[model samples]
Target: MKLDVNALGTFYRMAREGAGLAAGRLTHMTEVETQVGVTKLNFMRGREIRRDFEDATEKVAVRVKLTGAIEGYSMVVFERENALRVVETLLADSDSETDIDVDAGEFDEMTQSAVTEVGHIMNSGFIDGWADVLETVIDVSTPEFVEGVTAEPFFGEVDETPDEDDLALLFQSSIETVGTEIGFSHYLFPKRESMAALLDRLRTSGGIEYDKLDGFDRMAERGAEEVAKTATTLTGIDTSVEIRRLNFVSLEAIPEQVADETLVGVAFEFDGMPSGYLLFLFDEESAHEIVDAMVPMEVDEDGFGEMGTSAIKELGNIMASGFLDGWANVLDTTIDHSTPEFIHDMGAAAVDPVIIQLGENQEFAFVFDTVVMADGREFDCEVYAIPDENDLERALNNLDVDRIEETPTTAEFQELENS
Candidate 1:
């Protein structure tokens, strides 16, 4: 069972199309405007996945077992409040004289029934989209409802508590109702062999070994961890990686997904076997906080003026080295990055140059999507690492999967002279 960029791109498109259909169905049923949000494939360890679901906020998920073309589980998860809001809309359309208090924690038979219907329709739309792409039929089972403040309800259904090394293939699709502002997560989990067969059928190029996927996961995990460590060491803020995902998307879709308002960003172009651009973006407030944390004394600067910009660029330079070093160690190759390029403008404007440079060569990119944040502080940073398609394919092909696990991730930190 091997995988390639083309196969993964097809999977991404299939999921996106399904998400749109699901949104359409929701609009028709609830009579509320709806839309599909970010759709990406997530490769996470069992430990990371468990940590993600334990946010202390109650959640409701509709789980269905799949057989036929796809074999595994499909889950639709919603926050407790969002589920209540959606149920309210479904109940409003019914000819019932009774009004249930959703906030009172009373989900009776009728509410459960409505949620089930929503879950069923959503699953069908998603599976139908995939079927249309693969030209196969997938059978879905009865929907089962699970709700809890902890991860027990969901984890209990799974075979067992998976260890950290166990990798899970999770496809995430978010759907939001415009009027109610309700958001829900849809996940598709297919069996290993089934996924391998699907990939084999969809793959166009000579796919890399399936085991090589492990190298991709390790590099991303190590890079994200190093960036967080570098940020904390430089700014003295205890920052940590929140979410890290490998996304394949079009160059045109890149700018559209970024924040619309002005952002403080640090951009870099790295030259290596898989040469490409890397960017670290932060909100205006977060940038200010980092500047303040680095410079003890408050300067009388309006926006990020000379002193502030310098601080950001220096941080970016060191962080860039650390990030690339992680990859260099993984691939057993040297990756040199250019000097940090400071960007203070709208988010779309920051990425326009990179898009233009890469747009001529390829349509899609393998983007490392990561978020680093600190608890109880404004230290949020979004990291995007886009690699060249041909070069990346070449690098991945040369990767020695056996050595990745034993190789240590070390950041080459250099001292910056203060002017």
Candidate 2:
């Protein structure tokens, strides 16, 4: 199932720009420097996606049903603390008390109304962007606030969570102000097989340029250079990085691309403004050769022994860290990574866990594949950058790109002032 990478990128851009609008509206209403940015967007299986909210245990969400051309539901879910912060910020200038205790999950009538209004504006921002791109109008129902971790109201009446195979388009956005930041993931559950029509609408609307992620290409290129230099220094093996493929892809497409080939994959989880996974994949032979080069003395079996795995893990950690350090420098944000996990398995299986884990929050994954060469010999290895959608949106917003027009019209600005 090879999806159109261009339309997906356009959709990503649309969501990002839409979030920018939503953030502007929030700032207008709160009179705070609110920054709204898309953090994640993906089309994932319904049951797998629910794991995110289920693990949440408890949270606050504002939900609304969509009607007209598109039939589905839209929601803005916030962490308990951030929801409280939102309430405090919205009511700051009012005569009411401006303090919000972290433990206070319940909001007063005025506060609830204010939050619901924010949700309405955000929902409009997102749908309006979709309408403009697809050239269609979609109406939204009134926003309703609910507090629960199971997401009972959002899913409607069901004796138990349905595990049927249904697609969910999940979009997450983060609302940030000075000294206050909160993230909310929005999910849209349309009828089964609705995506084919949606994608067709997007494609027929226009041919989207597939390389819009050129921003990330530049970022990854710079980061790869850094990783190559660091690897050369650490392993004392002449090394270089050749970026092979860079594009946005969906979860289902990953296994197809990787196929049944076996490889040694070192995985790292990066957590930051836009969190994602970085995988260093190498052929078994290359893994062994690289391990041999890293270790001064190697006389064990040909395959990757305990010592070989540890050496490769260290090399991967160093290279991955160096690479993300470059990204952090370019994006001007902090990014922390998890310990590298080493796996020697089939290519599809190597990435399955990552896809499933990320699937909990998103449907698409950004893949930045690069080949690491040693001493002019092709290592037959790849590096993948599977970043969170919301974080990628934020990171992309930080970069200068040909984004959709985000400024409000004169009448709209006037309306904002009055509101």
Candidate 3:
């Protein structure tokens, strides 16, 4: 259907509003006004439609224009900073400029990439299913009636709905754009070798004590095991798993929170899972320290500013996959996972609880406890199985326990002992 002037304005307004929210800004956008002499064109074998917005502003008197088509849209956002600044301004009333300038050349490249990516998502015909709702909203809000229009779906189909992988790609793209705008090199998956090399350097550089090396090794081993188990379970594989070893770097340069020292946890899920997780655990100080390490000095002079929530969220996302993989394998059934939710400042008293419910009323619970070892003490790790009889039976039924190997009756154990 053709979008009239008012409808087009509404579309722009809605899109810009959403973009403003995504950009973390508050802006007051003037209602989109049609420029004189602008033309609408039909092309691309009845599959594509295009509209242009042009304006000669008094400030620069430049003929700034924006073109939107069926697949995607592009605009020359006055100045490079104005592109981001516009969104920021719309979202937030703050006048703070971005730490790094958006280079015109880079902006063009990234914009083109984003536009193309969004276009492919829209043109996939999956979005057509959502067209009716979109049309309904448009009809209710605007006086202009849409005509000859076939609505598109909502970017993904029932069977081919956008999953975690698609969301991850979009998240990566958004982060890269933000990082590039701030002059930071984006690395979603840091190389394992590089992390290992950094660990080696930290060990030799005397940044960490020689005696603490064993503790670090133990921690790394535990982390690797956790990640490996998770990966195997998720992938339904019985293969051995290997994880990138963890290392302790100097914490002196790290930021402190509430005047307490922080420790950083870094490990990667490798070998078993297709996409691995990067785990970061920190005391308040360590959390700030990592943020300090990541953010440019220009943006955060004291390394005590806001932590990169998006980056941390991505880290959690990766780790969630590994953990889910492990749990699914243990259960021998596939379970869908929602996007990982992040929690910060999780104190010592914080309890991680696992609650399992079966049938109508049977339930069981497990609480995770973290143990700290003394310098001179060696403690063997223990695994305790405390299964609820009813819940266990239910789970056994779900797994079709008949297929799994089972021991003979208690008589067999007594016979073996007697023998």
Number of clashes found in candidate 1: 0
Model 1: per-residue Cα lDDT over 222-293, one tens digit each: 787789889999999998784355667767778877888899999999999779999999999999999998
Q: Between 1 and 3, whose TM-score is larger? A: 1
Q: Which parts of model 2 have CA positions greater than 4 angstroms off?
A: 1-3, 94-101, 158-163, 204-365, 368-419
Model 3 per-residue lDDT at 398: 43
Candidate 2: tens digits of C-alpha lDDT, residues 1-419: 11244557667767776787787777777777878866445545565456656775567777777766567676777766677777776656543564545465467676667667777888888877776766778888778888777745556542223244465666756777777666777767765435556656545223322223445545666677778888788777787667643445567666656636788979999999778888888888788777877788855755777888898899899988888987776666778999999998898888888889888977767776666677665465677778876677667666544431221111100000000
Q: TM-scores of all models?
A: 0.86, 0.52, 0.23
Q: What local lDDT score does residue 13 receive in model 1, on the 0 to 100 scale?
A: 75
Higher TM-score: candidate 1 or 2?
Answer: 1
Each prediction's RMSD to truth = 5.4, 17.7, 25.5
Best by lDDT: 1
Give the clashing residue pairs of candidate 1, or none: none
Error of 3 at 170 (Å): 48
True lDDT of residue 304, candidate 2: 76
